[model samples]
Target chain A: MSQILRREAIYALTGLVTVLMLLEYFFWPTAQPWAETIRTWAIIVFNISLGLGAIRLLMQQSMNVQKRRENWQYSAMLLSLFVVMLLTGFAGYFATGLQTSNGIYNWLFINIYTPLGATLYPITGFYIFSAAYRAFRARNVDAALMLIAGCFVMLKNAPVGEAIWIGFATIGNWFQFTGQIPGMRTFSIVGALGLIAYGFRALMGKERGFYAGGE
Target chain B: MWDVIGLWIGWLLMLMIYSYPLYKENPAFRTAEHMFIGVTLAISIITNFSNVMRMCVTPLMQGNILMIVPLVLGLMIFSMLIPEYQWVSRYPIGLLVGTGFGLGIRGTIKPNLQDAIIDTITAPTSGGAMAWFNFLYVAVGLICSIMYFMLTFEHKGPLQGPTRIGRLFIMVGLGGYFGNTVLFRFTMLTGRAQFFLQVLKLIPM
Candidate 1:
């Protein structure tokens, strides 16, 4: 297809999808069976995407290891654990008559993955502290506003300040409303709008990087 | 004994996984990241498929073959795997996008519009100074935030005042985000610490 034709095609398809979704949301069939069918299809599609993503992740890590990258060992460890987890999970599932309770999969997930995932974010506190010490300098207007807001919220959330000041909760609520809530909402709206636009572009085929050629 | 050993080993492994990044990137962390992603993806896929086959496809195949419309739609998604046949992928994409948008619009109205707005507006008239202040904040916050998205006109006119206030509200929001970030980081540290102490045998694991 020619460039202009491709762009037009992309726009048309994206618009169609958007309209259909809107229709489905508000005015689609109310029948339980049809709704369930859509839900099932959605689940299947989501799973296929998940499988594809895993394959891609493995490929990326293997490439890193082959190139002898700085963090290749992490990749190796990750792959090993992955295989171990998958085997245990599937085997345990079948062994226990498809029951998730009291299985190797559930055990590993609860004991290992959940803890590690939750912990990963927390462990970054050292970095955050270090980063804040260096970067939280109130040298400018915006930075100063940020510093003030951060300090207030931190104080309110922490148990120490509430003990010292009875009004900390009130102050925290005030700060949250006047400062954080509005700002985040606007930013989120902007983000959502951008995503919608890009989504439209992709649907229309105007965004084609995922495809083989630039076309 | 074996279960205990495995648990401890897992904990040690978790610590090493986080710690290795500090010293330098190594095969251990890479292996862990890849393995986690891969296994998580595989398990999720298998489970989801089993569920789908059981609930949707099996019943359809057994009784009403015409009920396999969605199954065909599901297959259309695989068109993405092909080069020239890729346009077929759009069929499924269209269905998904349309359905998601339609659902979101209907689902979002109550939470986003009526309850949040009406509740804020109807806060008690009689209260202590702090209570009155909070009520006002909620009312103002909702309005200012909504205004932040206005695009038709420049915020330079009467909106200049409210929009400036809106900007301040946004900064406050960002500050909350920063605080959350700090908390999140500490949580990560605690995870690593737990791994070291309980699993790695650095303390007990």
Candidate 2:
């Protein structure tokens, strides 16, 4: 019974939903509202799945603290923050606690969350710049062209390049946008074809790598 | 006063993150990283949980019978926590995957496939001889780039010339993307530097 649910039933449900959507998209215009509703249900389902990661993190951190693993203090700190954040978050769940300027949740988000998130890209920029030396090496014709293009872009951005020659910025703009449009268009078409192919495979039960196990 | 406090806190956090490269691995960075993780995960879980309450449970309570299906499906997902009933989660997963792919294909079909082809073939020709030349050039480039993706037929003999042209287009496209990425990183670094300078009173807002 369980085997049937996991294998055949799962695939059947997927195919039905996919067919419903595709039909709404192409054939059954009247099914638009139904399709949208189904899409909403799917989003809700995916969001619920999001909690699984937090559950896993809580479990792992709890174990680390219990076992007194190396740097277990850090694990304890994480667990505390996780629990505290959850409490603060839920405190604001039913009220104006999350968004109101006077609320603790909003305060924590601004001071902690916003700063932490914003720092990510700027910090990562350092490592990328360090790695850029190796990456920009002209090992082949493709590498050389890419390097030249990167240089032009950088030149266009910097005032020094324009001071040397005004055409540097113009050439860079042409290379970055006009030169890449046709190729980008072609890529988009190919990517869409691939997506349609994958959707077909799912409909045919050929794409079973997702949720095909546990049977 | 609150804004000043937030600014100081943000400046300190930014300093902690930026110090990582200078010190290799440090306590400050690890603390920040772990705290970020915990807070981020908490935020995500809480947001999703609230969404569930708003979208599913509340609707079911208010007499929307259809909400029960997703509610049940979502509850079943937690069964994966138990070993024996882990198989039960596959139903919701299947539904999610199906909906995702269906949406993906549906979304891409018109914009990426249909309109893309239409745009390429019906290129605007109002900008004189240069416009005509560009249109023809793009048409050829697009055809060649597409031919590069056709792997079933070998790119030898008759297919060699177009195949090479396709490769060049691919490289140029890749180069443009690479350049844009580097420029983005540069902007980000500069922004961080500016923040530091502002905090030090070396620059004005």
Candidate 3:
């Protein structure tokens, strides 16, 4: 009974919703409202999943702090900050909607969160350069081609490359559109096919690990 | 006063984040990582909480019987906390998966597949000879790349050459991608640098 309710019933639900959604789009346009309602409910459920994640994190962090695990101090720090921000955000949300432009939540988000994000993102510039240094080594034909192409593109990006010669920009632009477009397009085509296949599998309830959390 | 304090804290935190590459794994870096995650999750939690309240909870409170379904489903997610009731969480997951997959499959049909096929076929169009050449090049590249992804066939005789050409296209594509990414990273660095300079009064705001 337990297995039937959890696995078979869940599969049925999944198949039903998927069929309804596809039908709404392809065959029965009148089912659009029902489809939209399901979509909205899915989104709401997804949002609620975030809370589930928080609860999991809270449990893990509390356990870590309790057991004095490695980097437990960091876990403690995370919990404190999480609680602080959680309270402030919830408190400010009723006062100001979405916490975008103005509010205590936005203030914290902008000043503290924004700076951390900004700095961390740009720091990748350094790492990429380091990566380029290693990866650009032309040990073979493929590597050499990529290196040559990469150099031209990098040169085109820099002001001095176009200043010295317009050919750099031309070649760079050529590589970007001609080289990238076909490969990317093919990838997307293959990817879309794969997505449909996955969707089909889910509809059939053959793919079990996704909904059951690897059970 | 609060604004000024916030600015200073932000700048200091920015400096701490920047310290990661310079100093390696350290307390400051870990602190920033923890703080960033904590605040981010908090934001997500708050936004979702607000959404649930506004969309479902409030409606249900006001006698909207339909809202009860979602509200109950949302609460059911809390079953994940108990090992015995963990399977109960599958209900919401199933709904989410169904809608997501259904919409995804629906979206791909005309937009991704049909349009892409159209572009492939109509690529060699009535333009200058150079335009024709470019289109031909992309068309061939597209075919070759797709051929490379064919799993059933062994790349032994005739298939090997096209697959090789496909790999070359992919390499060139990666190179171009790398260049674009580098340009982006440089742009990001420049913005951060400008921000730093402005904060220090070395440049005009």
Which candidate number would show the highest DockQ if scored against the true structure? 3
Q: List candidate 1 segments past 4 Å from native.
A: A1-33, A58-119, A167-170, A176-179, A184-215, B64-67, B128-145, B155-159, B191-205
Lowest-scoring 10 consecutive residues by lDDT in candidate 3 chain A?
A: A94-103
- lDDT for B195 in candidate 1 is 59
Shares of reference contacts reproduced by the candidates, in order, are 0.40, 0.68, 0.79
Candidate 3: tens digits of C-alpha lDDT, residues B1-205: 8877787788788778888887777889889888888888887887788888888788789997887787778789889888888899999988988888888999998877899978877855466897888888888888898888887899879999999998887777777888888999989999888888877879987
Candidate 3's TM-score: 0.93
lDDT of 1 by residue, A27-119 (tens): 664454555556566655554444545566777877877898976776766667677766776675567546254366676676666555554
Top candidate on TM-score is 3
Check candidate 2 and list the clashing pairs: none
Per-model clash counts, in order, read: 47, 0, 0
Q: Against the hidden reference, what TM-scores do the models get? A: 0.75, 0.92, 0.93
Query: Candidate 1 at A168: error in angstroms?
Result: 3.9
What TM-score number comes out for model 1?
0.75
lDDT of each: 0.63, 0.80, 0.84
Worst window of 10 by summed lDDT in candidate 3 chain B: B118-127
Second chain TM-score for model 1 = 0.84
Error of 1 at A16 (Å): 7.7
Candidate 3 residue-wise lDDT, A38-150, digit = tens: 88788778777879878888889889999999999999999988887877776667666655534666787988788888888899898998988776799998888888888
lDDT of 1 at A101: 49
DockQ (C-alpha based) per candidate is 0.36, 0.67, 0.72
